[model samples]
Target: MSLGGKISKDSALEPRIAAIDLFCGVGGLTRGLERAGIDVKLGVDIDSACEYPYLANNDAAFLLKSVADLEVVDLTSKLSGAEYTLLAGCAPCQPFSTYQQKSGPTDERWHLLGHFERLAGELNPDFITMENVPNLARQSVFTKFVTELEALNFHVTYGVVNCAEFGVPQQRQRLVLLASKLGPIALLRTKTKRKTVRQAIGGLPPIEAGEAYDSDPLHQASELSNLNKRRIRASVPGGTWRDWNQELVAECHKRETGKTYPGVYGRMEWDQPAPTMTTQYFGFGNGRFGHPEQDRAISLREGAILQSFPKSYKFVRKGDPIYCKTIGRLIGNAVPVKLAEAIGKSIVAHVASHSGPRKRQLNDWHD
Candidate 1:
């Protein structure tokens, strides 16, 4: 209910750079933007579950509405008092990710990016950015979105970038797009620090499978099946499923078709980055989410840490019970905080390089 930033008269005259995070799940992108020195004034998402975390960790207003339902007038007041505005988000990915089937369920999420495009076209903010699964770059909607931005005179650039290279301690790759009405804008390929799984979560105290550490509520691991318990014990760090005994091999892996899937039921290597953190990352069978030395799947907090979220980042209010399924989805779907921070830094540097006198700022906002 609290809109963190008030639209004051004097500040309105010299408005700061403000951003609205559309489809902002748990404030990942908003936090990163704030860290990169941008004032993200608002975050909007449809999920009621995301409200607590989004508001708790961010100094921004939370709007629990789908981007499809938004209009220019709806955002006029909310996005007020910004001399330079940015609209940033990663629309839901199930509709476009490789993990999701191309056909079946129908939902508004499929066209969420289209709605985002509509807002961008209508609001005409100074800058815009979107992050999503790499496959999204191959879709027609993405093509049309970029084409329309170019038509609107935006200097647009987009491509798939490896998240590990950008400071995230996971082997996740994502497509990133940056468009600016000012001048040419591109993601800064700075070759920053690359983190390993050990550097990120190695220091946390060991917790057994199905055990929740009271010291950190989010540091709870999911219960492994009796058979999975034995499977994980036999697993060596960075080893594949083939390392398991003949009786321990899954039924699917026995088939010729499933032989290629050596990535599952594996432990992470202490010196290397982890596999991509999926929504079911807390389940050992879901992916190579098992602990490097422990016998359990990586905990929810560990997954968040691999995604570059700080250890102290709050996902639920104190005294609130934790649900791994919902929290995992929020963490998996979130943009890596480090990647978002890099994107924000790129934009801020781009804008700072072209900044002119305060008197000409408003008039020079556009190309």
Candidate 2:
């Protein structure tokens, strides 16, 4: 059965357009799209850990299935009655991430994009979007995916977008693709003012490492080893382990290769956007996650805020012990919500322009 079909005119007259988010980790993209007036009907992810946050934050159903195992029929069934459908599949990006050891084509995750391409071809949704590490733009997989979308008669546009340019308080660059059968579409222009680390999370009540804030559980930082604590005490904001006294240096940093990773064990500058948060961002030793003046690594909430999640975004239920690793992975892996909002707005504008007065008439009828 074809994926595209109309819901009742009464439903179409509503203000929001509709989308389904594939590989929708914790519903970051879905949340942003909803904020920009798109109804994200469903989110699919392989990790069950995503279910809580995904459902808690967005008005959507969560499917705990790998994209490779997902049937177009299943997706079509869920999305069968939407007036305009957007299929967004931002497959696992670890294979293309610069921080990862280059696994090349051998990585199984590399093939997940092919699955996304296949589903897009089968569903032939009105619009398509994908986001990944900017390095993916240089890979053959990205080229093949774009070519396949074009072959399906999609007008595709893609570029590397800097999240800091779009109000995310982190220096993350991502490859964003927007394809539509309706007509040409592109990302909205960058915002004039960039958000800084101070602007994003500077107001949070302070908590020591290993301690959860009394009111906010996610604002807890991971505890440091005594040695690591000493190292952080000496580390300057934006300065690496090189600034440490010889006694405080990790033995690894004395090696040639380790010296090159100068961003590690570094403090964030209060006035600047934070460095890209990796899966291990809860640890002080990972990347530049240290707080500018707090003498502790950034808390889980801080990382989530940097990812542009609302300060109140819930990742875990009350009374549950917040595991740093689990929460860190969720926060670090999320698409910056602001970036997704920009994408959502662009899609909405494209549809509004293409649909023209018919959509306006529908709105008038509803009014």
Could you give me the TM-score of model 1 versus the true structure? Answer: 0.92
Error of 2 at 183 (Å): 1.5
Off by over 4 Å in 1: 1-15, 104-107, 357-367
lDDT of candidate 2 at residue 88, scale 0 to 100: 88
lDDT of 1 by residue, 1-367 (tens): 2222222323221235678899999988988887777788778898999999888777788988878888766665665656678889999988887777653227557788889888888777888999999988888888999998898789999989999988999999899999998899999988667799999999998999999898898999999899999999999999988998999999999999999889899999999989999899999998898999999999999999999988878899888999999999999999998999899888888887786513224333332
Residue 34 shift from truth in candidate 1, angstroms: 0.7
TM-score of each: 0.92, 0.92
User: What is each predicted model's overall lDDT from 0 to 1?
Assistant: 0.85, 0.84
Question: Against the true structure, what is every candidate's RMSD?
Answer: 4.0, 6.2
Model 2, residue pairs in steric clash:
none
Please write out the lDDT profile of model 2 over residues 96-161, one tens digit for every residue.
Answer: 887677677888898999999988877777789999998899889999999999998999999998
**Of the candidates shown, which would achieve the greatest TM-score relative to the real structure?**
1
